[model samples]
Target: MNTTKLAGNFLLPISLLIFSLTAFSCSADLEDKVVGNWQGYDFLFQKTEGPDIVVTINGGLEQHLRSKLILSDNGTFQKLVGEYDNGKGTWVVEEDKLITTNENGEKLIYTLLKVTDKELMTLHEVDLKTPDGTLKGKIILSYTR
Candidate 1:
């Protein structure tokens, strides 16, 4: 093939390769921003039953003393270690949401609202049902990194 034809044939592939590389790099940078140690606190509400009656209740707040978030390069796997007033537990991030299951099989879900070099914010919601009825609450958590 002539020089001009050969160059034209290779130009498209080269341009596509460069574009793909740029996109991958940008995504990787974003993922890096999400990976690190993050600490926060959560206020929770729960329903309780007394000898007399079942009641909707506000569970006292708990502080998250420390948390470490690790994200894999491909963003497929994430692990979280969170320390709270009661104890510490392992968590996982799925679909950009953080969830942890306690020994009692209670599942807690948290959505990451914002993360910065010095701060992190999350929203938590829990719903439960008992013989009496269903109860739910929304709580906001904030932390300093």
Candidate 2:
């Protein structure tokens, strides 16, 4: 092969390898940013037979419930506190969504609304089925780190 042709072939593969490595590194860094101690305000509303009840959810519930969430770099852990509820259990992040399971192993789906250096917001809804059909309660949680 001519000098120019050989150089072009070598450069092409090297450039592609470098690009792939950089992309993977960046993705790993972003995943780390999601892991840490985050504090924020949470409001939970539930629809009951009598009326709608609004409760302010914090780190500890009613001075009786205490929880902690430790999100690791691998997206797996034991008993991470739920942001909306006092339930404690494991959590996992798949794609753009975060799935939290309480001690009972019930899955809670939360979609990432907004995530910044100081704030993280998520929206979730509980599936409720009644004689009339299906009803769901919506919840929004805002947190600051």
Candidate 3:
């Protein structure tokens, strides 16, 4: 094969690889956009029960605790919920998930629903034991800067 033809064939693949890497790197930048203080405005917990496990929403005035999450540019974070303070620790973003580990080596993960300069929303699922059986629920958190 001629040298020019051989080089042309390699160029397309190289260009595609570069483009793919650029796109992947941009996705990772989403973490940087989330580095700031976020004040929790709404925290809704939906609990399910009975044979069908129907979900019921309990929030608004029922939630008395104030909460906040502060994320530093250095990959460290602190979470404050009411009077309880979850010790600071390291945090990272993997795809659409935010994974955080506390000072006590406890790990918590939240699914990123939406994040912007002004607002952030996340969802977390929890299983709790009830008198009847195991109940599945979700805690949805809405925050603002």
lDDT against true structure, model 1:
0.45
**Deviation (Å) of 100 in candidate 1:** 1.3
Residue 57 displacement in candidate 2 (angstroms): 9.4
What is each predicted model's overall lDDT from 0 to 1? 0.45, 0.49, 0.66
Clashing pairs for model 1 are: none
For candidate 2, report its TM-score.
Answer: 0.50
Clashing pairs in 3: none
Candidate 1 ranges with C-alpha deviation above 4 Å:
1-85, 128-135
The positional error of residue 15 in candidate 2, measured at the CA in angstroms, is 40
lDDT-superior candidate, 2 or 3: 3
Question: TM-score winner among the candidates?
Answer: 3
Residues 1-145, candidate 2: write the lDDT tens digits.
2332343345435434533443333424435555765554543333222222222222223322233445555555443344445555666655445687777778887755555566555556656554554545444455666
* Candidate 2 residue runs with Cα over 4 Å from true position: 1-30, 42-50, 54-69, 74-85, 127-135
Q: How would you encode candidate 1's per-residue C-alpha lDDT over 1-145 as one tens digit per residue?
A: 2332343355446434533443333423434555555554543332222221222332223223343434333433223434323433445655535565655566777665554566555566646564655555444455564
Write candidate 3's Cα lDDT for 1-145 as tens digits: 3432343355446434533443343437769878999888866454433233323223331342377789998999987767577578999988867888998888888867667788776766767665667766555677899
Worst 10 residues of 3 by lDDT: 52-61
